[model samples]
Target: MMKKSFATLTSVLLGSVVVLSACGSGDSSTGTPAPGGTPSGGASGEKVTVTLAGWTSSADEKELLQQTLNEFEKKNPNIKVNYEVIADQYMDVMKTRLIGGNGPDVFYLDAFEAPGLIQTGVVEPLDGYVTADFDTADFEQPLLAAFQTGGKTYGFPKDFSTLAMFYNKKDFKEAGITNPPKTWEELQDAAKKLTKSENGKVVRYGFGAAPEIARQMYMMKAFGGQVSDDKGSATFASPEALKGLQLVTDMHNVEKTSGEPKEVGAGWTGEMFGQGKASIVFEGNWAIPFLQTNYKDLEYGTAELPTVNGKKGTMAFPVAYVMNKDSKQKDASWKLLSYLTGKEGMKTWTSKGFALPTRKSVAAELGYDKDPLRAAIVAGASYATPWVDKATLPTIMNNFNNQFIEAYSGKAKLEDAMKKAQDTANKEISAAK
Candidate 1:
């Protein structure tokens, strides 16, 4: 799950097939000067291939990406972008290539991995390359800060997704629930009421949950728990953290109103909710297109995540366009990078709604805040925690998720599990450095 398969991907089976209509072609610069092309620089007038690397999600996703690149080529005739698709193990492949000095001029970097890569000095800091037209302030602040360390921006976020609660309208009506829960306690009560059983087996779970660190980080903070310290040490085993997480384990082992998607034979929350096996699930904007295409008949509504301790919070996952520090075409890469994240390019990329735009202006232009299904997701952006931490977050998260599953399943006491996970994570972190 390093590349996060949680992203909604289009396929014939899913019935969500995004069509990518072709854009302009890459004719030589001499053919016709691109309108407002990259500013003149070393070899801006000469044809140069600037390679880009990213992981393609599906045929539709890949095609849409290519369409965006085609648009870039049309605007910058002198710079030809060579797009490379890393099919699997994207981080491993990209890291290897970068260390070997064969990395793409520009490539995709998950915010999760940005901190570690930035620490290695392989990512080109974008602060010096920013143009007033690029508008760094236009980016959602938390997302923009995810790629910055020591006050230097190493990348510009390309797109982002935030967690929001999706509930089945039909289920709610049947259960006699008048409104979506606004607080964690209310959610629990509603979940118990919505859960249905048949012949001693669950017909539908009230909540479909993914017991992982990424989904529960906000919960950790709800009760004033520190997910990790400034030094990247695992500190989520404290009593305060457990207070927040008790709600999850209680929902699973005590209340029994919640279950993982796998328990219902569904691949993910979207599948669980789509098949009517779950009444509610917290998912990102990716779920909207998925439900529309595959479960057209499913009745659903979205809301901002239920408040925890009367506080609003959710998680935001963003991916960035990072240039290689060693790239021979730094200027060309910057030109393409700035344009792709620019207003016009962002609009084109996000118009189809595969992902949400990172730029505030682009988001306002797209009117997602006014979109019925997307409004909740957009609302969470204001208070959501960007899903990034010190470079050791990957390790700490792995340790917590691994042990916490045992607690969720009733095999281990949450108190003991959290302590074990924390100690193990800390030891590993200490060893790594």
Candidate 2:
């Protein structure tokens, strides 16, 4: 399935208005007008409006969120939410407004771009807002840790995605395989057997090789390699990392069981699997909803990504709700942020199976623990490693992704690809420092 991409925020904020209103007539404990109007007989006479920006393309999701916002407004009569839908190109638009000192009070922050934004001093730390009653412990460890930096919390994780093996059940049955592969070697063997051709024309491929950096990052961890060391330096040239890259390259060039991204013309690994051209593809949990909605005819099931040499690992990517440091309404922003990531909102947002809640309690409330696919995603969170490096990730990703494509196409050796990537990343990191 083709996963929905996040839109850049630049265009969304161009004509948007900043809303402000009085809450009540009487002064609050803070001596400020409540939000929208004055307090009347202990009842909130007005409303407080706050702006939030996010990339949500699904009408169902938007309706669900609007319902939740209505509930929040009913409970806290003083607060109202103005949620803005930024379709695509969210980052480019958001960055422009952020640099101009005028942007949404709260916005979405993906794992891939969080580091760069945090480094720019535009995001506010949330430590002062969080209290013991907030129940931070409800969140899973890896998910919660993604937004922490230098002993301060920069954002609250809302949802997460973890890599898992998506297999075509019909293809597996056709290949006479009754069970999914549990280890790297078994995966390779299964791929080879499932691959079929007729008269030199390939009819079906066993796997799809997505030469993107994120997919390769999971493989790197499976081989027990780290993208960066304690001092935050590039380590993609490590022997273990090279081995992981070689595994995928070998699958395409040596095993002849996998097709490159270009060859499949799907633009993504999950799409290839959903089309039945590939038997197995490693993709994130978000692919589940996409597949169910788009390719309802495909008989598919998901499992934990097969282990590498008996050592299990996968990639975890989380998107958090971050507050703007320069917002005129910081308190209102925090309140909205708190509500969205709070237990109730978490349940509502993740209940549709669009993404997994970062909070363990929220996952339980959403019954994810009982759902096999969601359970696998939650379980993978513990052993999952992040694909991003704290420094020079964009440059490193560009270098690695371009060179790795060559290896995937049999135009370059894995070792040579890694060597060039490592050198380029190291130079970029050094210059960045």
Candidate 3:
């Protein structure tokens, strides 16, 4: 699963040594791996155990990953996988282990954190391990690009999710709306019609707005504005960005059609929509299971987000399995990594639908494109902007979210808030440099 909050990489000096024994695996130095990532003795060599580490979001996710590993082990008896759950502070633990030379052979890496980690030279560049049969071209370009830098591949995205509009069917019917909005203007009109007020007091909001940078970055892209420049410094305060962002603030402050989760006493947009406090919300594939488990009676449907300025856009979150550069079992690890992210392996991993496959062939084989609820999500992947930038993204996101809420809550002008947020983020980036 993708990280809920952006975590910045803390620079750690590489000279310090912290000896920690990797668990669940035998000595890995017993085997001499063959060229092109094949285990020694052509499948039945001196056994090597490769460690794969990641933080699991749910028991189901952990079990599914174990099941996938089991299959891999059955295929390659020589390479046993030691699946390790980092449990908490995954990145911090990973960074420490990597610097101390005790990191797992292969580990999970979110697209957001890939750039920063790769820059430290801890993640193995995966291009040399790739062969023609790996079908690297099958992966979604945008998702793959997140783990790439300077024309070299660092990791392969295992899966991805894109934002989609989740609307309550009952609310739509009651408001006499037949279909989802196709444009920003239509969404505003529909939001006004769907908003409910009783006795001059606002009851249910028409839309649940997530006013954070993660959600608003795509909005900025609707105009010509971008999150950063070529140098990775913040540049989101331009007039073009405010043009799209003002639309959100105006809906909440002026039209009063939309409100954030906090205003409705909810913790998140998903909870706000599930509680019937908001008629619509932008969510991803992860919300489906949450709604199913928490609000089984809620009748909701998903659609691709409304187009902005004649262009369709949304944000994508992807995570990959990256090999540790210092891994002694590089060949064995590549075998496991290739299989897990391969078409067949990916299909088995994504069969339960808890996650969406990043491989185009796997997605098509699963028929998510035809499913009523997932079709919109599948459609968005083509045009979705990845929730990834340079190493400065975490700093940029924190400053932007802190100030953007002021504008969303009508406490500050959109232009002023964005200018402050951008200037503050850039200054921090410069100081860090």
lDDT of 1 by residue, 57-76 (tens): 55777788788889989988
User: lDDT at 430 for candidate 2?
Assistant: 83
- For this target, which candidate reaches the highest TM-score against the unseen true structure? 3
Error of 1 at 180 (Å): 1.5
Could you give me the TM-score of model 1 versus the true structure? 0.90
Return the lDDT, model 2, position 81. 69
Better of 2 and 3 by lDDT: 3
> Which 10-residue window in model 2 sums to the lowest lDDT?
1-10
lDDT of 2 at 414: 81
Tens-place lDDT per residue, model 2, 1-433, is 1242221112322223333222111223232322322221223344446668777645676787787778777767776667776665667767877787667778888777877888889888888788687788888777778788889888888888787888889889988989999998999999998887889966678887677677778688767777767666678779988888788889889889988545756756666777777888887776787678779998887888889867888878888999877665556667778888999877877777766888888887778877867677787887777655674677777777778888788888888877888888888878878
User: Candidate 3 regions off by >4 Å?
Assistant: 1-44
C-alpha lDDT of all candidate models, in order: 0.81, 0.73, 0.83
Q: Distance (Å) between predicted and true CA of 65, model 1?
A: 2.2
Residue 222 shift from truth in candidate 3, angstroms: 1.2
Highest-lDDT candidate:
3
Ranking by TM-score: 3, 1, 2
